[model samples]
Target chain A: MWYHIDPSSGTPIYRQLVEQVQQAVASGVLRAGDRLPSVRDLAVELAVNPNTVAKAYQELERAGVIETPRGKGSFIADRDHTVTEEERLRQFIEAADKLVADAYRLRIGSERAAALFAERLAEAERRRSGE
Target chain B: MSDVAIRLAGLTKRYGEKVALSAVEMVVPTGSFSALLGPNGAGKTTLIRCLTGMIRPDGGAGTVLGVPVGPGYPPTALKSRIGYVAQTQALPERMTAQELIGLCRGVQPRWNDAIVKRYLDLFALPMKQVVRQMSGGMKSQLALTLVMGGQPELLILDEPTMGLDPKNRHQYLQVLLADSIETGCTVLLSSHDLHQIERLADRATILVGGRVAVSGAIDDLKADEKRVRIAGAVEEAVVLGVEGVRRAVKEPGGWLLFVSGASEGLVERLRGLPGVTGVQVFSQSLEEIFLSYA
Candidate 1:
């Protein structure tokens, strides 16, 4: 899957990659054994320094979100063994907080927010199954 | 012995009575892309000239690629491995792109014909087109091909994309960034294009009014500088006195404060104040930071 980067965004590029890759794995868009793009290839595609991509991959590898198999490349790690339950929940909240804050700004309440989020999850599922 | 590709210490330059660069200093690490940013008359050109040993600094001392620089323009042997793309660079009007490449091949000791040919085709420049008839974009691509072909240890570019359309400017920046990545060449690019600098440069040194005003990693600098919008009213006097707060201006329904960092404690203090409903932090773009300094 292709990744998008906003060079002008306030978040650092490496941090953005961590979040994106985590979300992709969580959503099952990327599964265990799925290979991630090589550092040089991703950097050229994103038009950023290769060092930045390397840093992101290193962080992912450290967190056990992805592992680099010798001579092959980085691949998504098995979710159950990747991170402790507490750490996985922390990552989930970090991503969820942003979504909640956006909806809160529009005066959207929790029940409606839940419904909206469900629809989004269904939409994501549909796209993934090639419907 | 040092890995720094360029270093300036209290470098000063004067033109008759007027000063161009005044006690300016900066260091560009080897193999790093450093953007030399400034507005017009900010001594960008003067600094580049000094680094390349094309002009003598009236004071201070510096080095480029480990070689001592200048009581005056450096001799050919010292400058042989440096590639400089002058802001007002021009090609021979009667010379075709191929013929000019041939001419450079004869003089440049490190010339690589393969690179020249590769970039020429990459830019889709007509090899048979006379230099005089080429557009600004084509001419710059031509100049850059020759420069990169020589495989300089240090590549100094001054406003390399001065007069080009949006597409050409973007493409030129992409090629430049990619080349620097592939070769690990030490690059010091002088440009007013702050966005491009933010994209390609790991470090930035901003010159203002003949002095180096701000210099550091672009990421670190951007992190340290922030703009925040607080909903509801704010006492301008009270906000002004807050620690690390630089400036505060009253806007509709709120006050926009320019603060130096993303300190959570600062946000908590603002939230605790009367008439403050919410606070939103914004990271200042490179252009915004440039304008503020300039």
Candidate 2:
């Protein structure tokens, strides 16, 4: 799976991997049964510790986002019968709350912050539609 | 998660007449980002070499990720799992950056071409330029690229930012920090760049004269050593004699004191001292603390 990481950010590595994989799955960039790189391979590619990659994979597996076959490799799991929309929404809201809190701490006012977030969402949608 | 990636107990090393490392004990938690910091001749490099299995320890037996580190340890299998980047420029002069990385990919069990390309691009590295023609900073970056592209379970870097310009150093550390964050890979880097260490490391071990002067979480060390400024004609000796003071330096018209296990009470004590006008608790920069050790 393709991934990018920022070292200066306060977010931990495993969390970044988990979030990226989740986003990829949600966006259908990673389809059901799509074979992702092995933990070792991904670790090398990302210049990260193998254990760190393993932790991310483990978390994804626990979330039913990926499956691993012994001696084979990890692959995207079928999302059709996995997490429901309500659960997904719950997770999304939780993340949004954290973002809002961070923004609040940075002294971004509510109205402007909401407008900025909407702008970002629209930009993301446009990019997704290849506009 | 509790599995130890590296364990060293009573580890010692010497070079001819000088003791480089003396009875050092350390445990690098699995998937933790740990830094070793020390002044010149403080044995940081020697400790790093021992941990990487490049040199044998004199007085201790330990395991690096369950493989015995001394003689009779599984050779290639264990060695392959470790990525080591030394302070010195060690890349072959004839090979270009791309060629060198490609060579590593061929031998390493785990290699990521995409990751390698991304790092090269991010660092603005010249892929086709020969190592001999590269600048010092470029060579250092190339060395780092080689090790990072290998993607070992444990990373041991000895002053990886040395010889790099400020911009290159920032880029290098950014990549290094990103790798640690994204991979949860265990990292043991030795650097005199205290600010970088403070920014990147989860925990740190300070080596002084071949011994562990201090070892703990970075936050813990910073909290323990409170910077106290006493504005008065205080004698350096008297300030140093304060119960909690670890070190004291005479500044213009005052004394800057580094007190271990500092608290509000300690500040009050300093303020109450004879000839003291103002006593304030300040944060000690990592550089200041490192220099104190020296």
Candidate 3:
């Protein structure tokens, strides 16, 4: 319910919810035992169709991100959902493709791009180590 | 669910020399939220009137909720089950919202008082205020509330949020969507607000010159229609020769090729073309698609 769904964005509403729930799970914000808002409650809160919310919940259930029990309600599934290697590679490739395209446009040398990548990695590592 | 809420077959109408409708045909599915999009004088109002039995078409025939529609006008039974909140709707100036609600309630056998109370509470509209004293937005919302209170099977709203501010519009649409979800109301809302349509509607029918220009699931249309920017020395003619290409514009660096509901592999095919050094495929938003035919 805390998540926001931008109606103007090209992305579908149900997909937005799916991604938000996944992100929250990945960020440790939504624990395995946390209960998601009921379909009606979330629909009213989000100002979206209950069918859209229901579809999102159904997708999340199919993906093992949540569980819906009969006579009760839906809750986060008790499973460790990790990002697949294929998905990570796809993300990295998409980022790299865009970077390469921009570099080609700006005539940036490969050496400069490599050095920039390394510098950013070191900065991220330093932050991770509390530096 | 497959049964249509409204259907028109080669429906045509003319006012003097002007053609209000030209072979206008469309289908609004039961329990589905559909956006009827068109510019001014695009026969949107004419079509609505024909469906509501308020006006007789010059040619063709149609049906609303399985009731036949024609020149003589629709049956009273069919009219009662459908709710239509016209853009030009007017309320009695001296009547209070409460008083008017009472008057309207007397005519509707299936009217729900709870819905009236709930909508009044949501909009915070004073029940005692005369309609003429209300703002345009307030009057629009009041009319919609009155129509919706009847809990009709099919609801047609003609730009019901035209005068509402962004916040008010969002709230009003939210309430409407919630009601639709709860009651499975079949809604056909004609509005130029593409943002609202994109958010709330799953399907649409774009009208151009009183004819259906585009109609289908919104997502499929988005996927099919894309602006492909490819940087290469490839011949524009050859690329335009490719199937599904709607428009091809030659830019300094490349060509912006618009593919209309093209297959997914078309972009990949363009990427594989010789001299295609850089390619960018831009998926169109609903507004862009609407503008293309509008």
lDDT of 1 by residue, B1-294 (tens): 368998889999999999999998899999888989999999998888788777788998888887777654576765767899988867888889889888999888988988888898888989898988998878888888889989888899988987778777767776777788788788898887776677667789999989997898887888887888888877888887788788888889988888876688988988877888989988777788787678
Which docking class does model 3 fall in? acceptable
RMSD for each model, in Å, please?
3.1, 10.3, 4.0
Which digits, one per residue and each the tens of the lDDT, describe model 3 over residues A51-117? 6788899888877788888957888877645445676578679979999999889998999998998
Local accuracy of candidate 3 as per-residue lDDT tens digits, B157-207: 999998899889878988888788788889998998887787778788888
Candidate 1: C-alpha lDDT: 0.83
Model 1 RMSD to the real structure? Answer: 3.1
Q: Kindly report which residue pairs in candidate 1 clash with one another.
A: none
Write one digit per residue (lDDT tens) for candidate 2, span B1-294.
447888888889988888999989888887788888888898888888887767887788788888877885548887777888878888889988878987999998888887788788888898888999998888878887787777888898887887788876766776776676677668898887765665567677889999988787665666676677789988877888778998887888898887888787888788888999998787665566666676
Pick out the ten consecutive residues of candidate 2 chain A with the lowest summed lDDT: A5-14
List where candidate 3 sits over 4 angstroms from the true fold.
A81-131, B234-236, B272-275
Model 2 over residues A52-82: C-alpha lDDT tens digits? 5777898898777998878788989887456
Provide the lowest-lDDT 10-residue window in model 3 chain B.
B216-225
State candidate 3's TM-score: 0.85
